[model samples]
Target: MDTTQTGLPVRRGPRPRATTTNPHVQLDQNAPAELQDRLRDHALSLPGVRRGVSTVSVPGTVAFFLDTPTERPAVPDILGGEWGHIHPHTDGSLHLHVPSTLADDLIAAGWAEYHSLVSRGILPPIVIMLYGPRDEAELAVCSSIVEEAYLAAGGSRVDRAGRTLGLPTP
Candidate 1:
C-alpha cells in the first residue's frame, strides 16, 4: 500500500466514473406549428425519407420519428462523423438518432418555410431529435414551433401504434 505524506492511502485504479445522462434533455412549448411543418417538409425532401410523424406533448415538447425507405444516411462531416445505427422496430418504424444540435441547425435554417406550412394548418406538432451537442436554445426554438402546431390543431393528439403523441397519459 502507498501512503501519502498526510497518511492517506494512494491506490490507483480506473478513473472515477462520469454520469452519461444529459440534464438539458428538455423542450420548449412555444414552438410555432410552422416550424414543425418545415421540418417535415425538409425531411420528406431528403432522398430516402418516406414519411414523418411529429408528436407534441403538453407544456411543449416535440419528438419526430422519420421513416426512411433506406438505411440511415452516412455520417455528415459537420457532425464529426458521429455514426448512428438504424433501429427497426417491430411495428415497421425505423429510428435514427443523430446529434440534437445538428437537428436544431437544420430547423432554424428552414424555420420560415415551416411557418408558412403551419399557417395552412397542414402540419402537426413534432420534435426533431438528432445526434450532437445539447443546444437548449435550438431545442427551445424548435419546441415552440411544435407547441403552436399542436394548439392550432384544436389540441388534438394522435396515437401511433403503441406510442402517444402530445401529453403522455398519467
Candidate 2:
C-alpha cells in the first residue's frame, strides 16, 4: 500500500526554486546622490584605502565599509570613553553606529593614522559610511566613531548577545 497524505506523493530532496519575486528586494531607497558623493570622497581620502559600498538618505544616516588588512588600533585617547554601540542584526551582521560630531573627527584622525600606518608598510583599508538627520547626519556619524573609540578605551561591558556580561563585584 502506498503511504500518501492528501493524495500527494512525499518527495524527499532539494527544495524547489522560488519563482515569484519578493516585493522587498529593491535597491536601498534611503541613499541620496549628493550624500553618496560625499561619502566616496571622504573614504578615498584615507591612505591605502579602497572604496566600499555606501547608501544615504535624508532620514537615515551615512555608513562606510572599509576593507582593511589589519585590525584597527585601540586608541583610547581618540575615542572618548564609549565604544560605538554594536548591534547584531537578525541577518547575522554586526552594525556599529558612532555619533556624528565625533564621526567627523574620527575620519580626519583615521586619515592621518592610515597614512602613518602606510608609511610603516601596513595596508589597512577601511569602509566608512556617514548617516544622520537630514540637517546634520554626517556630523553625527563622525561623532559616533569617536564616541565608540572612547568607549573601547574604557572597555566593553556587554557581551556578543547584547547582554551584560562582566565580572562580579568583589
> What TM-scores do the predictions have?
0.24, 0.25
Q: Each candidate: what lDDT? A: 0.28, 0.28
After superposition, candidate 2 runs with Cα above 4 Å error: 1-31, 52-72, 75-133, 136-170
Q: What TM-score does candidate 2 get on C-alpha atoms?
A: 0.25
- Supply the TM-score for candidate 1: 0.24
Q: What's the lDDT for residue 103 in model 1? A: 32
Clashes of each: 22, 42
Q: What is the lDDT of candidate 1?
A: 0.28
Worst 10 residues of 1 by lDDT: 85-94
Q: Cα deviation in Å at residue 97, candidate 1?
A: 0.8
| Tens-digit per-residue lDDT, 71-153, candidate 2 | 34343222221122211111111123333333344334321112122224432222122221122343233333323432323
RMSD of each predicted structure? 20.4, 19.0
Candidate 1 lDDT by residue in tens digits, 1-170: 34334332222232222112222121222223444345434333333223322222222222333232133332222212211111111111111222333333334443311212233443321223221111344343333333332322232233223332321122
